[model samples]
Target: MVKEIERKLPVVHVCTIVPISQTVGANRIVPAIAIPHPLGDPTKTEEEEKVIRRRLVEKALRALQTEITEQTVFTD
Candidate 1:
């Protein structure tokens, strides 16, 4: 489904629980926190979590804008 979607769309950013972006064959991947809480860490304070989430979102947006021929992983 991901490959098919990529074929139709100009850009697609994928967020994964583990470091399986390459294994899954995603062209653009944003490394998420985890499987259950992909956006937040329970150990972090609310403010810190918010910052982390924002940064991840920004990275995803940048991945969408960047041009690449091969699979790429965006990290903090």
Candidate 2:
């Protein structure tokens, strides 16, 4: 799906989690917290979770702005 989207919209940024990113051959990726909770950790307080989510969003935005010749993984 990501590839298809990219093929149709070359300027659009596509990013996914780690292992799936590898599997799908995604060129842009952001490390996730986990499969079940990719953006938030259940064990964390609401404030902490918000911070985590914000960081992930920031990483994704950065990924979209970056230019790369190959696959790239953005981490916090």
Candidate 3:
């Protein structure tokens, strides 16, 4: 579903805690939040979660400026 969109348009995915190896099966991968919550887990401490979310979001922003044509996974 996501890969299809990237193929047709310019798209970047946010993969926070997603392992690079696991993303292989998918058509494309982006650096986002953790697996359970791609935007940050609500169960964690607010300070901790906010810090992690900020870092991941930063990476996603960086990826958006690149000219990648393959499955690119950003790291934090």
Candidate 4:
């Protein structure tokens, strides 16, 4: 599946609910929020979680605009 994607698309970004280790088949990918949640943990207030999610999304957006050759770890 990963090979097919890499063969078909020049650029691809992925978001996962599971940890990175689970995607052992994919060749190249960008990190993303967890799968089902797509946001931070549930310990914070709604407002606080919103802010964190926004920040994480912004970082993902930035990753799309670059042409680097290595995996970038987008900090939340």
Who wins the TM-score comparison? 2
lDDT of 4 by residue, 1-76 (tens): 5447656764434556324523554433446556666667577898998997787667656655656565444443
Between candidates 3 and 4, name the one with more favorable lDDT.
Answer: 3
Selected candidate, larger TM-score, 3 vs 4: 3
Model 4 misplaced stretches (Cα beyond 4 Å): 1-38
lDDT of 2 by residue, 33-69 (tens): 7778878988999999999889888877887788878
Give residue 61's lDDT in candidate 1 (0 to 100).
87
CA-RMSD of model 3? 3.6
Clashes of each: 0, 0, 7, 2
lDDT of 4 at 3: 47
Segments in model 1 whose C-alpha atoms lie over 4 Å from true places: 17-19
Off by over 4 Å in 3: 16-28, 31-33
Per-candidate TM equals: 0.79, 0.82, 0.59, 0.54
Model 2, runs deviating above 4 Å: 10-17
Top candidate when judged by lDDT against the true structure: 1
Q: How should the candidates be ordered by TM-score, best one leading? A: 2, 1, 3, 4
Over 3-72, each residue of candidate 1 has an lDDT whose tens digit, in order, gives 7688878555546553565776778888888778888888999999999889888888898899988988
Over the stretch 1-76, how does candidate 3's per-residue lDDT look in tens digits?
Answer: 5567766766565554546534533333555645768878788899999997787666666777776655556653
